[model samples]
Target: MKIDGSTVLVTGANRGIGRALVSAFLARGARRVHAAARNPAALEPVVAEAPDRVLPLALDLTVPATIDAAAQAASDVTLLVNNAGTHAVGHLLDMDLGAVEDVMRTNCLGTLRVLRAFVPVLERNGGGAVANVISIGAFGGTPSLGGYPASKAALHLMTQAVRADLAPRGIAVHAVFPGPVDTDMLDYVARNEPAFGDFPRAPVAEVAAAVLDGLEAGEEDIFPDAFAAEVGRVWRADPKAVERRLSGIT
Candidate 1:
């Protein structure tokens, strides 16, 4: 789908990759951008910069009420960016069940919910695209991240399924697998394990630009960053080898 002049809805747009996505879309000439986050106030800076193009809305992916409310507010959105996610760091067996559930609900189920709610909007607006921000964790195994990796794996599968289901409707579904970026999630992980400092990190703006480029290219799966692209190459060659490498990292 063309990036310019499209109505876009970006979840978790208050900060990190989500915030970068909002700015990238605006820079790419989107007609409007809905900056959705748990606290709408967090989007003040983005709104301040582009008062006429950016709309701030309260959106908590884990909360159905908030999701529904945000969907209603962004009823004209043609592009949906599922960037909201939760991370639980620990061994799956030792971690809290609630934490695991939160990750799955936010990263997996929440994405689907937003898509379902926005399909009609996309259909009305000539069927645009939905970008689901997945991770290398979707294919790789890292014991330290616990259920977070498993949740991303579920999202990866969901992305494929959504593409198959939505293709007939002309709604393009693109899955993004980004390796360790210099986001707070990685920062927290790095604090726990200094070795993470050695892992390659991409700037959030670069990742966002890559995502838009992939969307414009009509790609089904996007590994926007170089590190993620390298990981994808290895994954395709040998899934087991990739798993073994991630196992060593954790």
Candidate 2:
């Protein structure tokens, strides 16, 4: 759907790709944007950019009540961006079970909650689009991040299933797979874990712009960067091989 003059609700809008998306939407002439994050105060700088157009809301992914509240507050939303997610740092065997669970809880279950709450709002508003910020790693090949890839892969499957479910309802669900972007999340990973230090990163603004472009073009699956597009090609060529490689099975 076109972003111009459309109302959008973006989760995790305080930082990273979410913040870039908020700015990109404003640049593309979005009428109104609800920038929802865990702490609304963190969005003050964002609101300062376009006071009349941007509104900040409190939405903690772990808190279902807050998600429902945001949906209630952003009643005019025509587009929903599920961009909030957490990365649990560790390998599968050594990571604490709770940490791995947190990754799944935030990336998958939390996003599902947002989808459930805002889907009806979209339908009521005459149908719009839902952009799910998935990961290129979901298609498989990240050395670290504990259960992060697994969580995203699960979310990818869910996105496909939900797309089918929403097809009849006129609500389009788009899965966005982005490779390393130069964001705080990536910075932390690069600094703490040497594995990702040399990984190529696309600029946040460019990736954000690509996301909007893909949405307007009605692309069902969007690889917002060259690396992600390459990953998509590799995944498409041999899905089973990618799976086996990711699983460390020869």
Candidate 3:
């Protein structure tokens, strides 16, 4: 769906790619943007950009009640952006189980909860679009990512299934796979793991712009960065090769 004049809602809109998306949407002529975050206070700067068009809502994906409330409040939303996610750094077998579960809960189950609540809202608004901020990790596993990749892999399948189901209803479901982004999330990885300190990271604004461009072009699977595009092509050619490369097992 076109961003022009669309009423958009974005989750995790406090910082990183989420914040960038909110700005991009407004720049692209979105009529209104509901920026949802666990801490609505963190969204003040984004809301200030367009006081009349930006609505800051308290939404915690981990909280089902909040998701329902957001769905109710943002009923006129024509585009839904699921961008909240968590990550744990460690091997799956060696990482703290609690951390792994937290990643799964937020990245997988939490996303699902948001989708369930908003599907009806979108339908009521005459069938809008849903864009899920997935990751390149969804295609394979990395020894340092722990359960983050697994959760994203699950989300990938869910995106596809939901796309098929929603297509009949005129609701478009799109998945955006972005490689490492220059955000606080990547800063954490660089600080904790020196090995990835020099990894190429895409600018948050660039990635966000690509996502909006893809949506307008009717692309269902969007690679929003150069790294993501290359990785996606490799994986499509040979999944095992990409898996091996990610695992550092080649």
User: Top TM-score: which candidate number?
Assistant: 3
Candidate 1 ranges with C-alpha deviation above 4 Å: none
Q: Against the unseen true structure, what C-alpha lDDT does each candidate score?
A: 0.88, 0.91, 0.93
Cα lDDT of candidate 2 equals 0.91
Clashing pairs in 3: none
Residue-level lDDT tens digits of model 2 in 1-250: 9999999999999999999999999999999999999999999999998999999999998899998999899999999999998886777887699999999999999999999999999999999999999998797645567888999999999999999999899999999999899998888878777767778989999999999999999999999999888778878998877666555521
Q: Compute the lDDT of residue 4 as modeled in candidate 2.
A: 97
Candidate 3 lDDT, tens digit per residue, 177-209?
A: 999899998898778767768779899999999
Q: Tell me which residue pairs clash in candidate 1.
A: none
TM-score attained by model 3: 0.98
Q: Write the per-residue lDDT of candidate 1 for residues 44-127, one digit (tens) a residue.
A: 997887999999999887778887878778889989999988897877888898988888888888877887788888888788
**Scored by Cα lDDT, where does model 1 land?**
0.88
Show where candidate 2 strays beyond 4 Å. Answer: 141-143, 240-250
Ranking by lDDT: 3, 2, 1
Error of 3 at 125 (Å): 0.5
Number of residue pairs clashing in candidate 1, backbone atoms closer than 3 angstroms, sequence gap of 3 or more or interchain: 0
TM-score of every prediction relative to native: 0.97, 0.96, 0.98
Angstrom error of the Cα, residue 130, model 2: value is 0.2
Single out the weakest 10-residue window by summed lDDT for candidate 3: 241-250
Q: Please give the ranking of all candidate structures by TM-score, highest first, separated by commas.
A: 3, 1, 2
Clashes of each: 0, 0, 0
- Give the lowest summed-lDDT range of ten residues in model 2: 241-250
